[model samples]
Target: MVFRSQRLSWPLRKGLSSVRVKARAKRRLFGRMLAMKPGMKGSLIVVVEDDDSIRSSIAEILEMEGYCVNAYPNGLAATEALKRTEEPCLILLDWMMPVMGGEAFLKARAELSESNQRVPVVVLSAVSERAQGQPGVKSCLGKPVDLNRLLETVEKLCLSGKCA
Candidate 1:
């Protein structure tokens, strides 16, 4: 009688027998799940930056990491869009822009309904310290932002479910 181990060919059995292959697959799956953390799926992140390159790059990076992004050229456009669309999970605001600067946007955002006013803002500016005590401002990152730190801050805030 043929033994069970002898039923399969060596090549087929060898492919399935490697512990490294199984471990690698498990790690890949876990890494993907970790990248898009729970409570962050489908979350929208608004980016308001005057520089075309900066806005596009920021949006691209966030999208790659699994968050939906809506980028605006100026604060005025962002404020107007905010009224029409669902509230975003977070706003990345640049300090200076041609149409409406960050300060003006913050003021306008304050005058909105209570729900809109609660949305968290992260100021990305040359002088980020100026925004420290501002109401609704959750965090500040200076110009030439560290992408890793930005991601970490976003993960912390969004994971807490407070930004939603």
Candidate 2:
């Protein structure tokens, strides 16, 4: 299961509690790097959604969690973004949107080279839609995503070189 239970250890929470403010400040700096993860290499997460509020909110959360998030108003925009950029480090796709939905974008992204297509995508869907094992994408995530779970999934995908 890519999305696991979010149960932080007491010790870890205590440590985080001590540096909450520092974490917040460091979050944006790291996010602004256009990647998240240790070393020069970092992970890129694309958040595709039509709703402005949802897209912005998720962007904030992902950034705070130390992720390079690129928010798109729709899948078409995301596709164009992909063309300009290197590849999808990770994709958080909203199911329903105008002008090329998430599934369409997924199909398009799947056709890319394995090296480029290997970017794992976690679909953010409201309905019970799903994307089976594609060249890159990880799995489906029901709407109202648990941020902690999303973070865990991102960490797992970034570190393990495989979607959970």
Candidate 3:
């Protein structure tokens, strides 16, 4: 007897939406050339996001673009990692998370040595408005994040030496 293979329906299939597809394509088109500037390669970036997929995706993208990325599931883990690693050029932080949120993280970050305290942070949150004027936060971008804007912000900060 021969077995037949079955295809999943649209609803059952996993795939990206048109907007996401377009965004990804656009990112691929420009991610390499626009991601880093001269002398920016190997600069580290810390990503603190509770969502696994988002964290991994951001890390993968940044790594492909020649920056070193350290991703953690929450603020606590990221803070711990920060203590052990060389200072990152920038930090992309999420607002809400278990085991430590962005606000608390900022407070903790402020208490670290002066250099650590000065590392630029870009808050990614639904409530980005609340992050404005927060110490060490250079910028805030709302979620779901715009890939273009995110890349632009990273490039600007890292290239301009503002993040250091």
RMSD of each: 13.7, 6.7, 8.5
| Number of the predicted model whose lDDT against the real structure is largest | 3
lDDT of 3 by residue, 85-151 (tens): 8888899999999999999999988877788887899999999999899998999999877766888
Flag clash pairs in model 2: 121-137
Runs in model 3 with CA error above 4 Å?
1-38, 162-164
| Stretches of candidate 2 exceeding 4 Å from the true structure | 1-42, 132-135, 162-164
lDDT by residue (61-158, candidate 2, tens digit) is 66666556788898878877787786646678887789888778878776666655667778777773656554455777676776667777776766
C-alpha positional error of residue 39 in candidate 1 after TM-score superposition, expressed in Å:
1.9
Model 2: per-residue Cα lDDT at residue 75: 80
Give the Cα-based TM-score of candidate 1 against the true structure: 0.76
The sequence of per-residue lDDT tens digits that candidate 1 reaches over residues 65-147 is 66789999999999999999988888999987898999999999987777878888999988898888888899999877777
Predicted candidate 2, C-alpha RMSD: 6.7
**Residue 162 in candidate 1 has what lDDT?**
55
lDDT of each: 0.78, 0.66, 0.80
